[model samples]
Target: MPRWKTNLIVLWFGQFMATSGMSMIIPFLPSYIQELGITDPDEVAIWTSIVFAGNFLTAFLFQPLWGKLGDRYGRKIMILRSGFGMSIVVALMGFATNTWQLLILRLLNGTISGYIPASTSLVSTNTPREHIGFAMGIMQSGAVAGTILGPFIGGLLANFVPFQTIFFITGGLLCIASLLVLFLVKEKFDKKKAAKTPNISVLQGFQDLRKVPQIPALFSVTFIIQFSLLSVMPLMAIFVQGMHGNSEWLAFYVGLVSSITGFSNMIASPLLGKLSDRIGSEKILFIALLGAALTSFPQAFVNNVWQLLILRFFMGIFIGGLLPSVNSLLRKFIPEGMESRAYGFNTSALALGNMLGPITGGFISGFITIPGLFIMSSVLLTFNMLWVQKTLITRKR
Candidate 1:
């Protein structure tokens, strides 16, 4: 491989290791909660919601702070902090005696959300401008592939392995990733520019947040899509767990669904992004946002795993493109010097949804049947789509 390819791979692997560990728990949370001795429906719902929301609440609170630190120090340190912090917290997840304990660890995990943003900034900054789409697409695949692979790995592990065991495996993977980044990847900071690093300000992060007029609207668009996807997300394991199958099947089905989505997404995101280069990110984003909204409704109505997987597969096509498009558009808005900080703000918005998606999904799932949660997700997403239509897609800049 060429030097750039080698660097990208190291960063990609690091991101994959970090993100995959975090994602493994998503489909297995309900099962983990079940092991905690909460059997009652209402209590399960509450505990699940708490576990789901804990990550987001922390992520939202801490993302901007991490973003500022990354700006002053370096992207390299931020990535290291996130990986090592998460490795510790996630490994401790195996020790949780109850839902509250697990929630605490997940909250701690959320505080380290800068890994993805930092990695993305590194790619966007270093990549030859012309090959950015292909490069980012390749880099992003690790996260998407991890999401796809995590549930399956998590599910299979959960069968004979304890829910706590999942943590050790994920923690090990992440630690390996962190080590790779520290020793193998090099950060070539501009020493000439370092002396003048601006005032170490979180406030300046906001200036880039506003430097582009469309970001606020674009941010909302992203939140809606993620919110829709996650609304049904929390209940996947719960739904599968209740079916007549054993734990092995739970791993198979949950992993199957997530894997298929990831597999399809891996193909679709870059294709959509490349197409966006031809049409426009605005058009692809708006249309795909609507596609995700429409796709969400059917997932709620499906009766079995097969049906759900089919819907999720198609949903991946629309879902995969949103993040890349969001990033590609930001590359347009961000001040030349502030790619990492700008992504930090954009990431905060997505992290808001990721953090909130589960909590909110848990809440909806607690009150409603698993399928009903999809309707709620679809409704919220539809509102976001309509909001985009009203505020952005149609408006002339």
Candidate 2:
């Protein structure tokens, strides 16, 4: 097998393990906070919000640093750094005696985390240009699959084992992932060449990259895509309840509603990615944005959970096209040595979107109502589609 293909296969599993380990905490986070002796319902909720958002806050700040370092050194080493660092920090979270300790550990984990972005950089830089889209799509599917399964596995393990044990298991998984990459993934980095290249500050790197107009525009698209999709996530269970009424299986139905999109997205990612390679990521991105916007609009009017689920499934198909296309485009547009730095900034945009989406969703839902939030998401997606058309598609034409 080709070296790029070998890297892709290994990195896909590495991405899977990293994402699974990170998300596994979600299922038991609240319970773990309570275990730390925060008994007040309101206090638990407040602490939960703080601890959950802490990771993204630091991640947004730190991803670019790692990316810069990756460009200077090697992407593979950055992946190992993230995987191993996250392993230790997350394992320590299991031993925290208070919410403050847990919160600090979460922030530390975020500060060191860059496995996915680094893996993305490695794959994009190593893979043949023509195959970049497919590689990104496969990588995305791995992450999505991990996201879909993590909560389920975590919830199940919570029933049989102490929550602390789950953290240890997650840590082990992360460690194993790092080990796999260390042994299996091979990256070719020319230190002599990289040394000769002018070393620029991260801010300078950003300024330099912005000179290529498509870089910043693509970053905005990434921000908006994540923002539109995740904006509804925090309230999705409540939305399901509003549709289905109080039922014994509310949790089951909620899980179903949440995982269905990822299922379809995983199914569509590689297929859309392959298509993008043949045609162009720009066209795929435009069509996907339009489809996502159109699908999101009807979700506001859905009268039943089935209708909502069907709409969400279709939305996921379009969503599968969004980020992979963006990744492929970044590869095409970015300067040769700056791939890692550019992707880092893009990852930072992604983290910012992840951080803001739920907060905005929760706050806006009060004024607009739950159903209205769907409309808001739809409108945002529509605006993003127009932005892509004007900035990317029109410029290309």
Candidate 3:
């Protein structure tokens, strides 16, 4: 195998470990907070959102700073910084004596975490253009796989271990992941060249990125894609209940229906990515969006769990291609030396979307219905497809 491919494999494992470590902690977070002594139901609810989102709030501000550093220092160093830093911060969460300590630690965790984005940036910079799609697709699959498995493993571990012990185990896994990257990944960074390169402030960097014709459009794609997809999450269980009503195995069915998307997503991402490389990312993106939009509309109208499950599975196949395609296009549009910064900003947009999606879904469900949320998502995606065609396609024409 080529050196870049070897590096890709190692980073894939690292991404999986990192994502798994993160997810494993998430299931136990609410319980951890309760254990910290907050008993008021309202206070617990409030702290839960604060603790969950605190990391993203800080990460939103810090990602560009780290990205700039990555551009100047080295992408590998950025990955190490995030991996090691997050490992220690997460481990420290186990030692928190109060909600305040835990909240602060979570904030620190977000500020330090950027391993996956750094890895993605590194792969984009190193991999050949012809194979970038395949590389990105495979990278995304690692992340998806981690997401799918992490919760199950975490739930199982939670049954047998103390919550604090789970945090320590998660931290250890992350530390090991960083060590793997340290030994296995190779980057031909030029210290002398980086030294000579002028330092660009984060705001100025965004200004520079804005000057690129394709960037704003590309960033919008990231934001909208995340927003539309995650909008379904806040009410997925409730929607399932509405369709199937109460049952002895409603939780099992809900989990199965929800997880089926990840299963199909894992299978389809790399295949579609290779297909995109053969035809074009633009063509694949267009088809994927159209398919997602079409499939999503029927979900709002499903009469039973089976219909919903089948539609969601198909939706997953289409959604799988979106991010890898978007990332691949970013690689094409971003100036050669600034891949980290571009991805950093893109990551922030993604975090923002994640923050907003559930909020938007909750709002829609309040005013209309859960099914209406699906229609709203479909409309947003359809509009995004048209926007892409106009900005990226017709402009070239």
Candidate 4:
């Protein structure tokens, strides 16, 4: 294989492994918390909800900083740091004796969470321009694949082994991922050019964001898209419980949903990304958002697990291109040097959504039916889709 090909594959693989490890915990976390002796469903719900928030809080705090740093220092270092740091944090979560400890580790993990940003930046920089949309879609699918597979693997492991064992497996993967990335992905620092340039800042990143009208639209859409989609993510285990099932299987079911989505996404993302490259991302955005909003309704009204699974698979098909669409759109408007920072800012928006999804989902699920959360998700996405189509994707732009 060619040297650059090796680096890209290694970079892509490293994230694929880390995300697979990290994502496993989500499906089974609520059950794990319940087993840890938190008897109250409401309290268990709150902690479970707060756990995702802990991760998002850190990502929110550091993403712009990391984005700026990636612009100045090169994205590879940030990727390396994220790979190594998350390895330790995730591994230690296995050893967490209490919910508080788990929360703290998760918070630290979020702060260090930029493996995707780093890899995306590298690939966006390195990949041939004509292939940006397709490559990013395939690369982004690594995350979706991990999310899909992690829960199932976690279900099996958590079934036989201790919950902490999941963390150990995740941590070990991350450690190996770090080694692979550091060795396989070379960072040729252009110190001479960097020295000639002014220092990059978060404010400058914002200015870059301001220059693109499409970016603000993309940023707003990114947040709302994730917010609407993930509203139910935290509550899936609880939903399984509502349907009369044990906690052990939550991972499997969640994995099932994720896997369905991931598989559908894997098939659809490249197609969608390619379509966007041929036509326009702005046009693709309206089509995808509407389909996703339409799909969220079935999850609200499903009668059985099979119904929910079918709806989720289709939903994944509809919305699978959302991530790549956002990236493709950003690439259309932003300059090359700014792709990573722009994507990082977008990821920060996703982190913001991640933070809100769990906190709000947990809080709402405590007060109302988990299914009700889907209603709000649908309503929000509908509003966002209508708003974006009317304001951003108009003929005047």
Candidate 5:
């Protein structure tokens, strides 16, 4: 097998383990906080938001720095750095006696986390340009598959074992992922050539990349894609409850509704990626955005769980198209040596969207209700589609 293919296969597992481990603990965070002795319902909610957002907050701030370092050193090294660092911090979360301690560890985990982005950068730089989209799509599939399974596995384990033990298991998975990358994935880095490149500040690098025009527009598309998709997530379970009525199976239904989207997304990613390789990523992105908006709009009017499930499934197919296309476009537009840094900025934009989406969704749902929030998400996606049409498609024409 080719070296790039080898890297892709190994890194796919690495991405899977990293993402699965992270997700394993996320669904149980509120219960863990309550285990730390915070009994008030409102206080539990407040701390959950704070602890959950903490990771993304620091990740947004520090992603560029890690990217800069990756460009200077090697992308493989950055992946190992993040993978191992997250392993230690997450394991230590099991030992925390209070929310403050847990929050601090979460912040540290965010500060050091960039394994997925680093892996993406490595694959993008190493894979043949023509195959970049397929590579990204495969990587995304691995991540989504992990996401789909993590909570189910975590839920099962939670029933049999303590939450703290799950954290330890999550850490072990991360460690195994880092070890796999260390032993299996290989990158050809020219130390002498990297040393000779001019050192620029992160801010300067951002400005220089923005000079390409498409970079910033692509970044905005990434932010909006994440923002629109995730804004509905916090309320999804509630929406299902309303439709299904009170029952013992509510949690199971909610989990099914959530994981179903990821299943379609995983299946669609590689197919759309190959299509993008043939038709051009710009075209794929526009159509995907339009499909996503169309699917989202109807979701507001769905009166039952099955209707909502079907819409979300279709939405996932389009959602799969968004990020891979964005990454492929970034590779086309970014300067040769700055791939890691450019991806870092894109990752930061993604993290910012992840951080804000739930907060904005929770706040907006209060005023407009969950169904109304779905309509708003559809509107935002429409605006994002038009932005792409005007900026990329029209200009290309």
Candidate 6:
């Protein structure tokens, strides 16, 4: 096998462990909040979004810094830094005695969270141009697979082990994932170029990227994709519990529903990615956005977990194509030598969406039902699709 292929497989496992470890604690976070003694329904909802959004809030500020550093030092080192730092920060969450402590730790976690993005940058830059789409699809599949199994394992383990122990286990897994990267992944950084590449401010980097025609539009798509997808995260578990209505296995059921989407996502991403490579990423992205909107609209009305699961699974099939397509397009447009910075800015856009999505979803839930956030997300995605179409037309002129 080629070195890039070897890197892809090793990084795939690393991505799996990192994503799974990060997401394992999410399914029962609201319950954990209650354990920390915030019992008000409204309070629980607010805290849920807060804690979920907290990491992205800080990540929004730091991703570009890491991206710049990656360009200078090495993307691999940045991935190692994030993996190890997040492991330590998350493990400490196990010891938090108050909501405030948890919230702060969550913020700190965001400050160090970039392994996935860094890994994506590495694979995108290192892989052969002809195979980039397929490789990205495969890479994304690893994350989807991790997402699929993490919640299932977490819910089951929560039944047998303490939440604190789960945090520790999550941390250990992250540490191991980072170690895999340190030992297995190889990058031949040009030390001469890296040393001579004068340091540019993040603002200057964004300005330089703006000189490119499609970059701003691509960045908008990144934000919208993350915003629409994550709008439901903080509410999914609570929504599942509502459907379940006083079950002992609520976490398991929640995990099942969450994992179902990822299962479908894992199946669909690679196929769509290869297809996009043949036809064009723009078409796949447009179709995916439309499909996601159609599927998400009905999720607002589901009366049972099965209905929700079915809709989400189909939604996943569409959403699965989105990021890979976006990444492919971004790589296609980014100037040579700026892949790390462009992706970093793109990551920042994603982080902004992550921060805003949950916070907005939480605020909306205060005014309407949790299911209502689904409708809002669908509507936003539809608007984004139209925006993309308009941008495509404008680009031709």
Residues 248-335, candidate 1, lDDT per residue (tens digit)? 5766687777667787777887788778777777777777778877887887666667887888888777777777777777776677
lDDT of each: 0.75, 0.83, 0.80, 0.77, 0.83, 0.85
Which residue segments of model 4 deviate by more than 4 Å? 1-5, 187-189, 247-250, 395-397
Error of 3 at 370 (Å): 4.0
Extract clashing residue pairs from model 3. none
Give the TM-score (vs. native) of candidate 3: 0.87
Among all candidates shown, the one with the greatest TM-score: 6
TM-score per candidate, chains pooled:
0.91, 0.92, 0.87, 0.93, 0.93, 0.96
How many steric overlaps are in each model, in order? 1, 0, 0, 0, 0, 0
List of clashing residue pairs for candidate 1: 56-355
Alpha-carbon shift of residue 237 in model 1 (angstroms): 2.1
Ten consecutive residues with minimal summed lDDT in candidate 5? 21-30
* Tens-digit lDDT track of model 4 for 1-397: 6555676678767767766776687777877888777878678878888886788888988887887777778888888888998898888888887788888888888888888877877777776678778776777677666756676677667667878888988898888989988877876557466556666678777786788677877888889987877777877766765664665466677667655777777688778877877887777777878888888876878767788888778887777677777877677777756766787888899889878987888787656678888888888889988877776778436
RMSD of 6: 1.5
Of 1 and 3, the candidate ahead on lDDT is 3
Please give the lDDT score for candidate 5. 0.83
lDDT tens string, model 2, 1-397?
9999999988888888877776665546656777889988556545655676677778899999999999999999999999999999989988988889988998898899999889999999888887889999999888766765565566567767888998898899889889989999999889788888899999999999999999999999999987777676646656777889866556456656766777888899999999999999999998999998899888889889899889988988988899899999999999989989999999999888766776677666768887887788889889998999999999998
What is the C-alpha lDDT profile of model 3 across 265-368, one tens digit per residue? 78888999999899888878888899999999888888899998899889888987888888898898998678899999988887677657755665556576
- Residue 388 lDDT in candidate 2: 94
lDDT of candidate 2? 0.83
**Regions of candidate 1 where Cα sits further than 4 Å from its true position:** 241-248, 366-368, 386-397
**What are the runs in model 3 whose C-alpha is more than 4 Å off?**
25-50, 95-102, 156-163, 234-257, 301-308, 362-364
Deviation from native of the Cα of residue 244 in model 3, angstroms: 7.3
